[model samples]
Target: MAQSFGTFDIAVLDGGQYDPRWPLIHMTPEEAVRAADDMGVKSMILTHVGKFCISAHSWDEPFNRVVEASQGKDFRLLTPKIGKPIRLDGAEQSFSRWWEDIN
Candidate 1:
């Protein structure tokens, strides 16, 4: 399916917290990054978080892991503030690590 779509500037993927029991249904942060890479994505944002006890990881672990997984990669990992408007067409694409500000 990715080949049909070509490369994407942004890809929204599953960043649901990790659980050994249901690995096939939910994606770990590292896996999500890999999925983005698989699709030739230039940037990625993790979703499907914060609303369930679907996994063992903390509510914020997905974000942290996604950042770690993005290391040395060419693509950017975006975690914008909820309800904040992101200007994707801008000359520079940047997002705040807002998750860092919370406990």
Candidate 2:
């Protein structure tokens, strides 16, 4: 979906990879960031996370990894709460690192 955008304002990507085998199916957090950076996306959102157990890592791993991987990178990662609204009017937005506090 995102790859075909050429250049876009935002990208909503799934931050999951069941395992190494499925990374090609769905991107890992790092891969998503790379893709967004390569595509020149200014803002990116990670969805389909903390809701599944396809991989061996912790549920918050994707969120944490994405944040780590995005440092000094070209895009902003938006981790919006479920069922919440995020204003996309080109205004810079900040979201709580909701996954980090988990035990």
Candidate 3:
């Protein structure tokens, strides 16, 4: 359906798991934003979030940081519900702040 919806963008980096950038594990939020920008990505989707206590910085901290860093950046941040299908019709996508509803 590239002809139908049009090609949106390339690259979806994992922008979570922690900071420091050592041990070469996962890309932090800030780092991910930078990388995406450098790669000239137009849109990004951050998923697999809202896990229970994976890191010490709360369940939603990393995701929060990603949102903060994405502002004024080159690409758009798309936070869809985990396991949900997101239609890429070249139209703007909106998602509810599910984390805010958490206890």
Ranking the candidates on TM-score from highest down gives 1, 2, 3
Question: What TM-score goes with each of the models?
Answer: 0.84, 0.83, 0.77
Window of ten residues with lowest summed lDDT in model 1: 84-93
On residues 45-100, what C-alpha lDDT tens digit does candidate 3 reach at each position? 75435665455557787678888888997677877767666767777668776677
What TM-score number comes out for model 2? Answer: 0.83
Local lDDT at 18 for model 1: 66
Query: Going through the candidates in order, what is the number of backbone clashes in each?
Result: 0, 0, 0
lDDT of 2 at 55: 73
Alpha-carbon lDDT, every model: 0.79, 0.79, 0.70
Model 2 CA deviation exceeding 4 Å by range:
1-6
Cα error of candidate 2 at position 22, Å: 2.6
In the range 1-103, model 2's lDDT, one tens digit per residue, is 4467666888898776447856567788888888788888878988668876867877788888999999998677888766678878977667898776666
Error of 2 at 5 (Å): 6.3
